[model samples]
Target chain A: MTATMPQAAVGASLSPAAVARIRADFPILQERPHGKPLIFLDSAASSQKPVQVIEAMDDYYRRYHANIHRGIYHISELATEAYEEARSAIARFIGSPCSAECIFVRNATEGINLVAYSWGRSNVRAGDVILLTEMEHHSNLVPWQMLAQEKGARLRFVPVTADGRLDMNRLDTLLDGARLFAFTAVSNTLGTINPVRELCLRARAAGAVSVVDACQAVPRMPVDVTQWQCDFAAFSSHKMLGPTGIGVLWGRKDLLDAMPPFLTGGGMINVVRYDRTTFADVPARFEAGTPAIAEAVGLGAAVAYLTAVGMERVARYEHELAALALEKLRGIGQVVVYGPGIEHRTGVISITVGDIHAHDLASILDREGICVRAGHHCNQPLMEKLGVPATTRASFYLYNTPDEIDALIAGLEKAKRIFKLT
Target chain B: MRPADDLSGMDELYRDFILDHYRNPRNAGTLEAPDASCEDLNPLCGDRIRMDVKLHDGIIEDIRFQGRGCAISQASASLLTETVKGKTVAEVAALGKDDVLANLGIPISAARLKCALLGLSVLKRALKL
Candidate 1:
């Protein structure tokens, strides 16, 4: 199963029984829309949750539903324990040395904003340059733009090659006067798995703090912050098969402790008088107000499930899926697949056919109960760089199968016929 | 390809006339130094349209729209241009979203309602209606 197989027979290469067991864990797979079986290929937008993650959240709400901390009651103590345990679970999941470095925010957008407002506002000075890449999602791009405008800092872009990869030729000049470097661990559209450790080290050597937007990377692959030595990383729980409303922001404890808190409230403070307030330590200082209790518990369960399945196996499975998809997609005439070679990519596929609008293609797929994302995918700059109005994207996860890829090919053929494209 | 899953259902939404309008949009350019022009972008889906109108004696003497988006948006803009040509400012102002949908001859989903009406939105903004 390690070696790539032809697209038509890739399904049987892996252990079918094991893949079936994994697929059975997710209840949403049984859903039939328009009296047809669902073939979800839009995991990049948000992944479907498994029963284990669902049960964990349900159990939390059914029993031990209480405000965490500041309660002498038994349920409160249990709730607090569960929340803190989830934090530790996530920290261990990402291979962070300490749990205190993990702070729960709303989503990846908020996680980036937290660093932009707190760490960025304090450290970024006038005339400083913040280097970013062209393929960044709006979440990672906009916050830095705002920070640059507010702090009178300059912004530079690292252009992506036509083959949908970072241009490594001009890295030295891009790093030259950059105060901070923010980049994605894995491009959501192109599925470019970046060299996180090397990029982080380069930024560190240049006296710049690196922020890794791992919203697409953490679930699909293993991420070790200690090895990467990046200053900060952000990811969303929902995108990784956990419930929405919970995201993680991991930073070096020293950087987090020194930076000002993002939001001010009762829970995040240590001493609050009428005059001024002192914040709590690392994680607590950033986690203001009552957080998403059940969502955190669900995310903890998701991490546990992934750990049990093993990230390496998950990554391998996704690679197979991606390779097969690329082969099949390329075989279809006039279908241009956007991204690196399958060897350097994940299961995310962005493609376009001759004169067929992305939205129209998505609609046609939806009619066949195949789910795919259309439009700019929150990467308008990337769309501009690619010279396409929009692209139809189909992303995969562990629960996906080769049969679904076949259905996608069939669907595209049908769309081509309908549009008189062939 | 199976005939049962043919584009008959899609034809209900994207009629031939709509596709024709999208393929050959009328007035798909800028009215130079127009009396009014406004660009409206749908933040959620990223569909954008800018309507430029040249007014004379409180009447739209010429109008054009420019932007790239989905078929529905571009076709709707083309259809809007066809519907409002030579009409008085008050007459165009009195027209509403229902008029465009009626002329489109399709049932629009809630998610695509924005795309269908994006042209109208830009026109309304351009005329301050």
Candidate 2:
């Protein structure tokens, strides 16, 4: 019943039965691309929604569709309660100390920008250093670059190793005198799971604030902000089987209270009198007019579904899947997979077959109804470091199966034959 | 499972000649002290091309391309070199995306249009057209 068992006995943990049960909740799994069964392997980009998440949003819009906070009518009150309840659920899901510390934005990109513009503008002075990693997705890299450029601050990076993991040997030197140490808990391009707790502690020891881009980590594994001891963390709902346009920014209560408001507008103010106005509380002050109401409900349902499934099981299942994929890819002889070995990575596999370009490989895979992302994956700097124009990435989620991995292998074989690589 | 006919598009795209062009590009190097040279990148996919051309009497006397990318991009660059060799810069300027598509002789999806058009864009830039 565990992933440690042989392949025949391993399906018990997120087993075929469990995966099939989970797959049934997703209606999009029934889709056929090019008259072939859809094998979704791009969950790292955006995960598909389950019926629970979809229904929650639908039911909210159908029954209690009203603006929150201001309306006191029956349906409005219900809508407000649903929105607040979603916030509380998300706060609890990430193990934040309090619900008020969770701020809802459009997505994880906005979450990072919120901290960069609000907390960064205040804390980061001229000549201050902002430390990052070479493996950062542009979402996690660009905001800080912009902030550093505008604030006259310098930016330093922890280089990625040959195997694509962060080079931690240089951490002390990089964190020295750094004002903020912002890094991804799991690299979107490399799939390397960083030691978030250790990195946070090191940043604290260096007298620097820590920010975590948990977009990939929060979906695949359990994330407890309180345990990480990081000042701020950001993650998106769409990558966790919820609707798009809603994400969470979890920060320390004192930090959230002290930071200036990111966007000033209606629903985020306390006293507005044609002149200047005082802002509302932490979460509200960050969330501007007309937040994603039904999207919050969908995210709440997603968290509930994940809670029911248990994140430890998801993490273990994905680890097993990644190990199986790496083994199979190694057997192919021509396939080169990126990132660290199975022990330090997730189910995201970026690969190159012989000299076949990623786009060409993805095109052939599409003919087989296989969905894989082929590009820099929004990590052009990392792509440069890896010395490849592009890579074809196959990322697994709870619904993916070993059969799908076999299909991907078969598709790659077809691509090789087309290119005459063999 | 689907019928084999549904997947014929891949064959058309990776046709033997296209693959031949990609594997063994016609003119795949940089020109030394070239009359005109330009480099461009498909930022979305990170495909890059640096084109160097030698011009004589307003004609592209010699041209070569050096870069790395997908089969479509490299093949298109190879095919473009053959198409514009010994042609007047004005004639190459008149060449459009349709001409490149006709040379490629395959249907390209909207998503892959950038990949297919990258060579021509770089060629135009090299000629300063």
Candidate 3:
């Protein structure tokens, strides 16, 4: 059944069945925590793996464990075939025109750096502008800052409204004489699902290349690179119930073929000598050194599992869960929810209690076996702009139930009672 | 909110003295004195502080600070101001690393030790020592 119904009802009816089935699918979620079932609400940071993804990796390692490519051995041939199969799976997931355009890296940060150091450094001339948003994680912002510094290009920010959504007019203003525009499709801290298609259309009109950081978005919603028509996109596997140390960067094949390699190493080369070396084709030119083979396989399995459940269902369920969380936290009255209330937010909810340190509140929650992240969330500039030292963030995923949201409410009540915040 | 009973060992770090200072910080705002000011940050961890020291007769007449950071860093700033307020420049310069470490009485991981010691590092940088 479609999970678009109100969350409280889902908890009472639909979620119990869903949870039973889903919990069985995820072995780790069944573990006891102080005699209580584990409540994982930090999926925005990293998601727990399902058996499908785990078994896929196990099957690869056990059956076809060998160095991929450059070997005529049977295991190597099998390993190479499996590795390329995973690449094709990822390209299909993201709707890339060709599997050759996808480059594998350590994580989303490295993917962004690849674009910044190579594409940005090469294309961006002095006095040209690179547009970004104040809401960006450092991964998307810092590399551009360094590129601007090195290339003598201007790094400009598209102003975010007081309510945390992007100001399209300000983005238009910032795009003047711009070489490229890079922004997050979903803010890690604010939980704003950016209008990426609209932004990309505008960026194209401005003659600026558009790069979407889909690290938070790809896992939560359907991301079709062909439909969005972004020049480049990056996302991490760990954030989507796959293993860490594997990330995907999908760019238009033409753009990727034209750009130079960010790293120089063994696997990414076509030919090398003492004097000069030639790089491989589009994707291999970017993928340097030994790649995370098992992790990529796991990510392929994750893609297959997500496809089975369907992304629209995941999105619908997450939206309901987030609204429930927002309603419950707002009911407390002392907590201030950041971002566009709860209605327009992604699965993340960042909050602060009146006169209580975010870190202290998080520590209190941790004592009750309810884990949440507290700090600037690696966005110090955003924290400064928001005029808060830190915030406590609770993020949800497909596996999270509305019962867990109630449990969170209970935990917060205990925290309030202990801290006398009420 | 205070830590749990199982976190008793952390009491040395989150002592009443430190928590009291954190809750009700002393000289927390910028100093209006004619002394020089220095702003420093541990960029790796995003810890920052601005120290305002008022000097008279080569001795610190008043020391105030203003900034945002974690408990360990902020509490250490409070303790540093208390220790160096009336001390001479030469004496403050002579302050040992052990003295700074003793003031922050917690077992700090190597990565976090640098974050905890940031205030002292800034103080030394200010002293040109």
Candidate 4:
């Protein structure tokens, strides 16, 4: 909440000193990949972990390493406290009233699959419509397709406009008779920031459940599930400066209680009878095995780090960063940036240069140690919407600066020159 | 954060031959009356290629490939067309990832090897028919 950075100087609000201090927190940012300074623009794919997160997991392993819960021993009790407190920390960060409503899964993909398998089967039936958007990551889209196919429900998409924003004018028709409305807070490929709050309310008005995939949004902006009034939200820890292999799925308590266990095993059982077996409650029932104990500790640290940095400042800085990158990229002839205009989007920018394919641009950038993401970004339907095979994306995060954006522009210019583009 | 003095690191990988093949790909159209045809994709990048082989008396009279992908994938596909044009089905069947990589004449990193060998996969699949 201590976001006192200047509104106009959003581009330089993170003062040279402040930027240096923030960059110092992340050890990997100091690394020189391929003997070149690392300009990591692929944070949308996965953010680098700060030393605080690294140390938290290391401290847990060195000191209180034990299986959580069902333990009376001191180390086990401490481990349980760390893990459970991480759940509480995440709940507080996202404005969930209760930590018990959060379920720890492998990643966003697994979390989406869990909901599709558990809730979709029970709530959705034949002739139902599971509505999605064209810009959804494969994680969010493929699961519903499989579930709808299995349940004989029809799959629908809210078309993305040529500007890359969702076609919100058609929401009434898309949400008509829909069992569920699944969407992303931000388009990872096109950088479109959808009206999440309005969309969720409309889904509610249309008598549909809203499931928001905030995998990209939570890291860059302030997301309050209570404010959005969504039924479920999912995101990955790694994308938020934590370690991989751990993700969070927050849902209404009553809904999770009603759904069956996603994966059945020893950890999630209440009784081991051969014939008829009972199950545990809510979060426990959903988390089916030994969980990512250290990764959870690291996630706790990551949330802590973001909290200290202030989400508003993070959002403001990234907005300026996107604006800066878009301005430069657009100046170059033949460079067409996708997604909504600068003010309407996030730090994610996907672009296409004259005849240079995305992979070729990405490879050229790699030579300069400026990491970017290319290809369809797992958004093939969105690719079809954009009418391009693939695009080069430069996604910014809190740690990125204007200088790195300059490097990206320079690298791109070199790519144009090397490829003989006028 | 300047780009290296020269793009030597990339220039070595995007050799003139590879770029030549990429820009002006040879045997890049579908063939009619093909004896055998097969398609495969580099699932990681979504780069797909389809190979059509017109066999005459157990010999490959003509071979062509059609697809869209990265330069390495398209060049590899174009190069494979030339390598297999006058060969027998048995000869083409024996081709593998190494032969394709060597033909491309570049040190392909582990990650991009799939792009380099995508055409070999299509050809091997085609020769099986």
Residue by residue across A1-422, what tens digits does model 4's lDDT show?
11432344354245557778999998888778888999999999999999999999999999999999898999999999999999999999999999998899988888888899999988999999999999999999999999998999998899988888888899999899999999999999989898999999999999999899999999999889999899999999999999999999999898998999889986787987889779998789988878999999999999999998888878887887887787778778889888888667999999989878888889889889999998999998788778888899999998888899999998888887767677
Docking outcome class, model 4: acceptable
iRMSD per prediction, in order:
2.2, 3.3, 4.7, 3.4
Q: Candidate 3 residues B21-85, lDDT tens each?
A: 66677778887764667889876546688888888998989888876766667777788888888
Report the Cα lDDT for residue A306, model 4. 92
C-alpha positional error of residue B38 in candidate 4 after TM-score superposition, expressed in Å: 1.2
lDDT for model 2 comes to: 0.90
Fnat per predicted structure, each in turn: 0.44, 0.82, 0.06, 0.32
Distance (Å) between predicted and true CA of A189, model 1?
Answer: 1.6
TM-scores, one per candidate? 0.95, 0.96, 0.87, 0.95
* Candidate 1 lDDT by residue in tens digits, A1-422: 33555343343233668789989999999999776799999999999999999999999999999999898999999999999999999999998999999999999999999999999999999999999988899999999999999999999888899889888787768999999999999999898888889889999888999999999999888788998899999999998989999999999998998999999897999899899998899899999999999999999999999988888778878888888788788889989999888766888989998777888888888888999999899999899889998899999998889899999999898778766678
Instruction: State each model's CA lDDT, in order.
Output: 0.88, 0.90, 0.81, 0.88
Model 2, range B1-129, lDDT digits (tens) per residue? 444354457978898999999899999999989999999999878888999999999999999998889999999999999999999999999999899999999888888888888999998988889
Model 3 root-mean-square deviation: 4.0
Between the candidate structures 1 and 4, which one is better when assessed by DockQ?
A: 1
- C-alpha lDDT (0 to 100) for residue A65 of candidate 4: 99
- lDDT score of residue A225 within candidate 2: 93
On DockQ, the candidate that comes out on top is 2
